[model samples]
Target: MNQLFRLPQVGEADAIAEPSADLRVPFAQSGTFVCKFIIGEPSDQAVCCGAPVADGKSWCAYHRRIVFEPARPGRAR
Candidate 1:
């Protein structure tokens, strides 16, 4: 089988890199310009990537690619 992407398994979300202090923002501070990707545990302490989002996108280029990865060609099926 040919795989174009590998989705992270459950409980692996916490492996996300620690967001830099300057690039982290509380959920309430997120907006069109801030990456909407949530990081950290779901709680008042959680933050979103405050990195500048890609043009016209709610997430930064990195996160966008993770969420919208292209599907693998299915000819192998």
Candidate 2:
């Protein structure tokens, strides 16, 4: 599979070194933008599949279909 595009952190001078793959996309850090798992919206979902979550995600394991990989194609399947 081809590598997926992702948004890099904003306001970072070093970010210019490796420009973000997608600039139109914006990530939420809390509430609606934040993952439901962390906020306890749904405990049954598996956002990262036992893997450390990123900025926003909702899930732990044996639940939702979100998994994290080094070179993830894109969001979870």
Candidate 3:
């Protein structure tokens, strides 16, 4: 059973070090739009989900759904 759930391979660590370019949103001059997800060692880096956000919210559409949406009754997560 343990074989069904395996840890990430050694080389896989590097792949997760940086977010994909496609997922990053272009920074605006005023810097009004910024992702609430923080990255980096000191936790200073922020993610840009490449999309607009709803009013009165900090995270982008993707993050908002993951962070705020309620889990389904039969879902594992």
Best-fitting candidate, scored by TM-score: 1
Tens-place lDDT per residue, model 1, 1-77, is 67454456423643556446688888886767778788767787778878875587888766765778544556555
Candidate 2 C-alpha lDDT tens digits along 47-73: 211332354445422123334433444
Assess every candidate by TM-score: 0.57, 0.16, 0.35
| Model 1 alpha-carbon miss at residue 44, Å | 3.1
For the record, the alpha-carbon RMSD of candidate 3 to the native fold, in angstroms, is: 9.8
What's model 1's overall lDDT? Answer: 0.69
Q: Which regions of candidate 1 are displaced past 4 Å? A: 1-21, 75-77
Q: Which stretches of candidate 2 lie over 4 Å from their true place?
A: 1-30, 38-66, 72-77
Quote the positional error of residue 2 for candidate 2 in Å: 9.4
Choose 1 or 2, whichever is better by TM-score: 1
**Residue 49 displacement (Å), model 1:** 0.5
Index of the highest-lDDT prediction: 1
Q: Candidate 1's error at 46, in angstroms?
A: 2.4
Q: Model 1: which ten-residue window has the lowest total lDDT?
A: 5-14
Question: Clashes in model 3: which pairs?
Answer: none
